[model samples]
Target: MQPDDLVLLTGRDHQRVTVAAQEVGLLPGTRARVEGRVLDVTDTDAVVGLADDLSTRYGGADVVISNAVARLLPEESQAERADEFIDVSNTATHTILRAFGPVLRPGGRLLVVASSLGTLGHLDPRLHHLFDGASLDQVEYAVESWRGAIHHRTAQEAGWPVWLNVPSKVAQVAAVRAVAAERRAHDLAASTLIASVCPGMVDTATSRPWFSDYSQAQTPAQAAEAVLDLVFTEHVDPALYGELVRFGKALDWHDGTPPGEQDTMVTP
Candidate 1:
């Protein structure tokens, strides 16, 4: 179908992303028209208000892509940044799903942007420490619950398709830096999550800067197209929900052991 698709952008104000999208003809009335910007995905009241507005205006949407991320800090500064990240990134995601879930149509798609940081460690030493006491099983369980609740409420039928785009560490870092370089903090956390859930970096308004790196990256428009393809062509089974879709290439760690290799047994 022609890109007359209705897309809701949560936190995209950076010039690079906007310019790239426009250059690639993804702007409204082009490939896809972005109907709204949540402005403040971190604010519960704002998120609810935006959701209500979208429901009233469009009634529902074919796709809802959330690209938000939390602020990063040094390990010594993590104790303070942790709560902030959770509130802005994790908690805000839950809030958006809760608010918009009921309005989404059946068979419609919901894409949650997550980071490879949420999956593989070792890429960033800071993340290794951040996830020190974390449990992937528990984290995955929570994500499933959130997805289930949102999909259940949004779709007309019992099953609503939800997918996650989880990109690797380099891609995630590049995405964050893209926005940070532009000083766009509104949806930084959300954007990070969006980059995370997708299979690879997208070539859209948000990802152009990363592509400029040449050494490691994909275009945001490419990423956007991939996301659309996944929503329309992929057969998503709710039972198979919560899969982390990586972007670009997977990270290669020479010295570090691969995931699931660490011994779970506690040392005496």
Candidate 2:
């Protein structure tokens, strides 16, 4: 948190967001102005409205970090919440990019705080096409197809595993790639970065419930160091712009497994 920076934190829970701001305010000698707003990121209109309001007030923002996510309980997978999952995980990125990307200031950063599982490798190769394309409609169709397949018990046939999170995570990274491609096609200021970051397995409510062996999970502050490194760097590597990064390095786009899953990384 920079002394000159005015941070805007949003979440669905008003009290939670307020408390977070107050906590930031308490950081020693920090003069950062933190404001909390009630935002349900899954809502398209509301997200765009916030972006418009911000544009009017701030002209544009220097950074936009997407930390929104939604996951059903492990028991709910068979019950099938694929559509809701995609809405929260996949389409939410589209909405974020559309609203925030344009107004990102020169040399600004746009980061999606995704999971390490959010890689093309997470999904079977047959399903890779869902995320490889840049078209927004492609993303929409893929989400529609997966939800339909899950509803019909054809997800496996459709090249998706019973666990829906892998695909959702992959799609989230793909959304970052799509926006990155768009960013590259146009002229922009130096050091402008657009990428999705995986904070690894953090010991948080969102992740704690999903892992059977939580021994390797990093604390929230620990996981945040890698992510904050990207945000604060003076010049981000160009190679990392469109990629899904873990621990300040880009992950192999086509690899079947991300390194974090293959072995635990030593905490720095």
Query: Highest lDDT among the candidates is held by which one?
Result: 2
The reply for model 1, stretches above 4 Å from the true place, is 1-5, 12-32, 36-38, 73-76, 119-214, 237-240, 247-268
> Candidates' lDDT values, in order?
0.43, 0.76
> Per-prediction RMSD in angstroms?
14.4, 3.8
Residue 208 displacement in candidate 2 (angstroms): 1.5
Per-residue alpha-carbon lDDT of model 1 for 96-188, expressed as tens digits? 556655665555555666544334332224323322332333333433443444434542132211222111232233332222233223223
Error (Å) of candidate 2 at residue 183 is 1.4
Model 2 pairs whose backbones collide: none
Report the CA-based lDDT of candidate 2 relative to the real structure: 0.76
Task: Tell me the lDDT of model 1 at 112.
Answer: 62
lDDT of 1: 0.43
Clashes in predicted model 1: 41
Candidate 1, residue 32: the lDDT equals: 62
Residue-pair clashes per prediction, in order, are 41, 0
